[model samples]
Target: MFDQLIAYLDSVRARDPAPRSRWEILLYPGVWALGFHRLAHWLFDGELYFLARFVNHLSRWLTAIDIHPGAKIGRNLFIDHGFTVIGETAEIGDNVTIYQCVTLGGTNPTNGVGGKRHPTLKDNVIIGSGAQIIGPIVVGERARVGANAVVTDDVPEGATMIGLKARSTLVPAETWLREFIPYGTPCDEPCEQGNGGVERVEALERELAELRAEVAALKEERQVPARSRKTGAAS
Candidate 1:
């Protein structure tokens, strides 16, 4: 227990620029969530499922970070900021850094009774704020997911992923670790689409949807007339 506390403190001190003291670290959401998670995970492993859930609920209420008791999380996991969610079947490895509003969620909500639904993030992976890693995909060690990106496919080790489509560019994990990119990518890199560009695309998409609806209505109208003509011929 003493070692775990020290490790958690050390991890927070090393990763975060905010908290000045160990006392401050204790007040952080990540520390509180992880502290409760340890006890909850122990209860869950012992098959005390209801008790585990009760503990988890309390933790969520207090921290606003929801990490399921069933999730397999390793040491030095840093949940930066709050509102981070780690799903029931999600597997997280050691030294993972997750920013606020990140979700390691399940893609298929229905049909499957019990199986791995969420993603598996290997050691040293960094998930930026608002990133959603859905499905049973594997994010290999030292991979990075950019903010607001939605990743559906598996990410290779040392890869840097970005955008809504989750495009990846590979870099050696060692080299990536040596230099840190604050928001998962350098500031100089151009955005895939600016706000104006996005708005224009959205407008075009709406127009396209209206056109498709109009075409569908025409097709239905033509089919109805054909059926009526056949009925008249038979009569």
Candidate 2:
């Protein structure tokens, strides 16, 4: 427990810009949430379900973060800000960072039987603020989910997931880690640009329009046939 607490503090200090003092880390909601989570998880595993849920409720009330005791989280998990929701069956790996208003929610509402409804975040995954990862998707290691992105499918390892459909920016995980970008922005690309398929279709349509205009101009500027010119001259 002491080792895990140290790792957690280290992660928070590394990521956040404020509160440089060790004492200040106590005030961080991320710390409180995870600290309580440890106890809650312990109780849950011991079959003390009621006590686990009660602890979870208390943590939520104090931290404004909702993490089900059933969610298995690893060391050095940093939940930046409050208002984060981690559902039951959501498994989080080590060194994962999640910003405020992020939801690891279920895609299927009617499936109340509750299998693995929430998503799994692999090690070193960073989910930006306001991002929603739905269903039992696996967010691969070192993947970045952009702010406001709605991810309904699995994300490839080392990819940057962005846009409404969660298209990858193709920036590798190493590059993303090296450069800390806000709002999960691409290291050097615009966020709102169309995806590969959309861009390809747009480019093809532009080229086709240009080709059609060229064909029409060539037909209009074509010279009269030699035979027709001679016949007209004879007439």
Candidate 3:
């Protein structure tokens, strides 16, 4: 009973939603989330459509957190910051940690009757800020996804995923975290923009787009205007 209580407390603490507030709002968010998770999980199992969506709508309204009712989350699933998103097909094991802005989505077509999207995280996995783990990949147990890493592939157990497309390597969480600055910027090369990789990638992507636009403009100007076929003149 004590173990169960401790597990529940851990679960609540892990998903604390209040930030920039004093002690008052600190623990309340987690309690609310616990109640919400319970409701959402129940709805998922029972496939109660209207009630599930209603509860999810209310939960998102009250909490910035948005977790699809179809997602199966195990015990001690803490969500810090509340901007975290878990897809409908997402399967979360026990003792998972999801920070703010973490996205577990599916790249599969989001068209009519959306296909199976969203990644599954096994037990004791920690997903950092802005990390995107998409597709039908499986993140192994005790895996730590670095802040802002974009992961689209399967992750092995006890691995640390970092950088664009998320490279898995054997590294300690403390060591990897130490390489990131306090403002969430990564100390590494490609991940230098935000304590994580996505920021840097976004920067690079913006620069590439600008360069492409410039090249296109130059090419357009170098070419002559459309020629009048009858007059044989370039206008």
Best candidate, lDDT-wise? 1
Q: What is the alpha-carbon RMSD of candidate 2 to the true structure?
A: 7.6
lDDT of 2 at 27: 92
**Pairs in steric clash, model 2:** none
154-186 in candidate 1: lDDT tens per residue?
A: 999878899998999665545576534554654
Cα lDDT computed for each candidate against the true fold: 0.87, 0.86, 0.72
Counting clashing residue pairs in each candidate, in order, gives: 0, 0, 8
Q: Is candidate 2 or candidate 3 better by TM-score?
A: 2
Residue 163 lDDT (model 2): 84
- Which ranges in model 1 have alpha carbons more than 4 Å from their true place? 170-175, 179-181, 189-235
Give model 2's TM-score versus the native structure. 0.75
Ranking by lDDT: 1, 2, 3
TM-score of model 1 relative to the true fold?
0.75
Clashes of 1: 0
Tens digits of lDDT, candidate 2, 1-235: 7776676687778877787776799798988999899899999999999999999999999999999999999878888899999998999998888999999997666856768789999988889999999999999997889999999989998788888978988765556666445545564644456586688679999999999999998776665476678899999
